[model samples]
Target: MSELNHVPRRPLIAAFLSLCCGPLGQLYAGRGKRSVTLAVVTLVLMIVAAPIALWIPGGHVSFKLLMFAFACWPVFLIVDAFQCARKARQQRLHWYQRWWLYPLVFLAYLGPVSLISELRTVFIAEAFLIPTGSMHPTITPGDRILVNKLGSRDDVIDYGNVVVYYSKGPGSPLYVTRVVALEGDTIEIRDESVFVNGKQISEPYAAFDGELPTYPNMVSMQPVVVPPRHFFALSDSRRRSMDSRMLGPVPIDYFQGVASRIFWSRPRQIDFSVSPENSQIGAIAWERIGMPIR
Candidate 1:
């Protein structure tokens, strides 16, 4: 009788691999078919969950709950992997269970995931930290936001959309402002009020300082038509904003994206304790998190 050719499988190592990548533990346990199925199922569920959550009211909370459940998926995989490893340790080794093949498979899986992540960050959406209170009342300093990179086109942009665009030059830093007028529309500003196409537009999000206004000349403008492929933008905090009235109409190509949501925020201070003025400083602003931008 031929002697059995058994290869040892360490349960701890299998669990660790599963924790790193959900399907990796199953693969290490010599259950290649199960590994593939689990990976596929996880991917499909995540893809489906996003849109479903967005369709519901207060979807950000629902989305977070769904993600928390998804996060626990690896824990289940880890337990299964540990059991599989213990059971398979004394069994005859399969032809595909080569020691070096595990690393190769891990690398193969990692490559595509990394590529997709990079592509999404570049073209789909990216996060940014607000550096100034120019858009004050609506968006404040220390706010971390997600910007939709696909809304740069003229057809997709409209009044009231908060946008990130380059000013001065293409190489200059990005500026965040709200669209006040679109191409071919006549726009004017009267002190703190804004007029578009001969009508005063309501701007509930705008902020004005009672003391005075910087660039006060910018607070008022003679009606001017926005040129083709150009649009006018203004900051919500008109008192301190340097926008279209100062930089002129922005070209369509200058836009980067539309500000989508405030994902996180905190007071920008050294100490995260109660301030001398009794205001909470350096602490996370919970109310701002997951807030959608108009």
Candidate 2:
């Protein structure tokens, strides 16, 4: 299979493309070339390693490794582009004759990822973590989740829904919590009850047996209105969570990706299974393994 066919056709192609750009070279090579498989594998591994490098903080071994990986991919991309163009020309492909088109395509691939994620520091999922608790008993912290990097871009925040967003850091981030109130919606958590805009929201998720005004002041005010584009989020576990009551509203821009699926999970620690329910509380959480973001 792919493991047995680990070869990079154009060293310059592989290096420049993988280097000057991040993983675009491998993306271009894709399944078309013999070397494409290994390139793709490298890119994926690089992406997985990226966050650990950043989390290592400025200058650690992991960070250094990530930096090297990030720097190295574009080299492969450039080389790939050149070779692809060359091949296209030899094969009499018209796009090759344009000459300048090559760089244009390369630039397109490079700009969005580098500028959007790196410069703006937008909260995209470099990765995700498993969640635990009943507040969001629906989704435990330890459950593996895949995030859609460009999911939350809506101007109007809907109520009674699950949302994953960036909340702190330059944009402290990475969570899959539920939306309790939209901007301008007054929410009160008092005496173990919730009222939004003077009316309570119907929650099927909060199955806990107690309550108190989570945001006493904000909830008691004359129905506070959520600011445009801002959202009030809380753990389904209204009482103990350090959500909006603790950190205020979740800014829209902090949004990186929406919860997508659990590509993999290890409820058994080391055993491989479809789901914990089958594998049964912390078994493997099979039902959620490949579920999509709602």
Candidate 3:
């Protein structure tokens, strides 16, 4: 007599496990060798994708294609696991194939994966959703941005660099604006014209939003020297940007990172009519997706 018990694998169980993590479904279906191979492949793909998604400067369309490929891969794995389970004959269960081992294995894998992801978010890059149009034409409301936390080095920051930083203090919320003045530079605003070190700097991205004459009081400021280890930032939407003008010069340590690109964006309502089926609702701003932030 055989020493082990033979039992049929459930297709639904296999599919669900695959959905959780690529190789898991195959493991449940008693394909130990295939599951190990799939696990290695999936791990390699994730390691490759992370750096490309964060640092590579590809075309907006190409970035979307990468995202689409990643989304489709899991679906392929799930389907494969389901079909394999359906065709698999009853087989002797090994020690690793115990019913209790499934969830235990999942938890063991999930713990380390979650930890690495959280570490990356804290020290490398993080995604943010724009809730206001303070940056306006440069960064509109509903735009989802990727911020490079590793690129916030004070030495690399320069005039016109868009940065994300703390609003007031270490524990405060983050704000995004363009750097206009560096440490030890004299910065002034006269009639909405910016001057760094007494020379008026070009501001092609600046916008008045048709309210130029209305905020005359807020548009001009006397010359102010940026202190050591500090920088001045302002919004492109001069008429209504709550930037360094309101918050004052920001300390270098307060900076979180540089705004990298628009990973995703929600479409404006005026661009398309609403559909009864809600198809148009929550539509994406396709043109802005993957656009780099200068």
lDDT: which candidate is best? Answer: 3
Assess every candidate by TM-score: 0.80, 0.49, 0.88
RMSD of 1: 4.6
Residue 199, candidate 1: C-alpha displacement in angstroms: 1.5
Q: Model 1 TM-score?
A: 0.80
Q: Estimate, for each residue in 1-294, the C-alpha lDDT of model 3 and write its tens digit.
A: 322477888999999999987778988887778887877777666656655776666669888888898889889889989987887756676657777888887887677567767877887788998766668798987789988877547665778989988999799988999999999999888888888999999888888874454543368888889999999999887776688877789999898888888888994422213431222226678999878888
Top-scoring candidate (TM-score): 3
Cα lDDT of candidate 2 equals: 0.52
Clashes of each: 0, 59, 0
- TM accuracy, model 3: 0.88
Give lDDT: candidate 1, residue 84: 89
Better of 2 and 3 by TM-score: 3
- Single out the weakest 10-residue window by summed lDDT for candidate 3: 269-278
Q: Each candidate's root-mean-square deviation in Å?
A: 4.6, 13.6, 4.4
lDDT of 1 by residue, 200-230 (tens): 9999998885346556456678888999999
For residue 1, model 3's alpha carbon misses the true position, in angstroms, by: 16
